[model samples]
Target: MKSRKRKIQAPVGRAAMLSLQINMLRDECCAVAAQLMKRKTLDEVELEDCARLDDALAEAYRILRHTVAKVTLARLRRKSRTRQQ
Candidate 1:
């Protein structure tokens, strides 16, 4: 029997990884929002539910800022390298 070679996949880039994180965070926020929306009236919603949604939104914002900083840093580095060359 002959052995077959398997193709290896390339590693994910930093930006792609960050993008996935952002998407997951968005899904989480949507889920929390949906839970709150299930109630017929605003009074029906619990404080914990509101807090949960707020926390999720804060986390999403943090991740977005971090992603922006990383991309900006990468761009700056690339520009500096090109200038030096």
Candidate 2:
């Protein structure tokens, strides 16, 4: 029997990039939320700490929303182009 090699291709396309960005932001949001929860449970959370986490979470969500919007627009543009052709 001969051994065969398999090739792995990197993700390519706007959708793939957007998916990667969304996954990263999701992970960041989850980590920040978990830290906030841990602090709350310990009753050591301060207003400043909460505010900082809130800002971080909000920013991540904002970026996620924008990335989704970009993906949607790209899909729509591609569809329209196909229709035009």
Candidate 3:
């Protein structure tokens, strides 16, 4: 009998793929925030690339922080829920 498993190749290393995914997610978050600020005052708009980069960095941090928090919370909740059951 032949093996039925299919192997997938990564275009880049694991670290590189994680980095790129984080960067893309950060960019997407920043883009959404930027669009929300488009109708705001001049001071609310990102006028410099550095400022935009900063926002992206902050958003990335928030994403990571929230993801960790959520995972931890879910794990803890699962334990409690299982105990209750």
Candidate with the greatest TM-score versus the true structure: 2
Candidate 2's TM-score reads: 0.47
Task: After superposing candidate 2 on the true structure, give the runs of residues whose Cα lies further than 4 Å from its correct spot.
Answer: 1-45
Q: Kindly report which residue stretches of model 1 are placed more than 4 angstroms away from their true locations once superposed.
A: 1-44
Q: Evaluate model 3: give its TM-score.
A: 0.38
**Candidate 2 whole-model C-alpha lDDT, 0 to 1:** 0.64
lDDT leader: 1
Compared with the true structure, what per-residue lDDT tens digits does model 3 show for residues 5-57? Answer: 97664333443455557777667766766765686565444446546665777
Candidate lDDT scores, in order, read 0.67, 0.64, 0.63
Q: Which stretches of candidate 3 lie over 4 Å from their true place?
A: 1-47
Candidate 3, residue 74: the lDDT equals: 76
- Each candidate's clash count: 0, 0, 0
Of the pair 1 and 2, which is ahead by TM-score?
2
Give the TM-score of each candidate. 0.46, 0.47, 0.38
Cα lDDT of model 1 by residue, 1-85, tens digit: 9999997633336556666676667677566667767766644446466567667756776876677677777878988999999
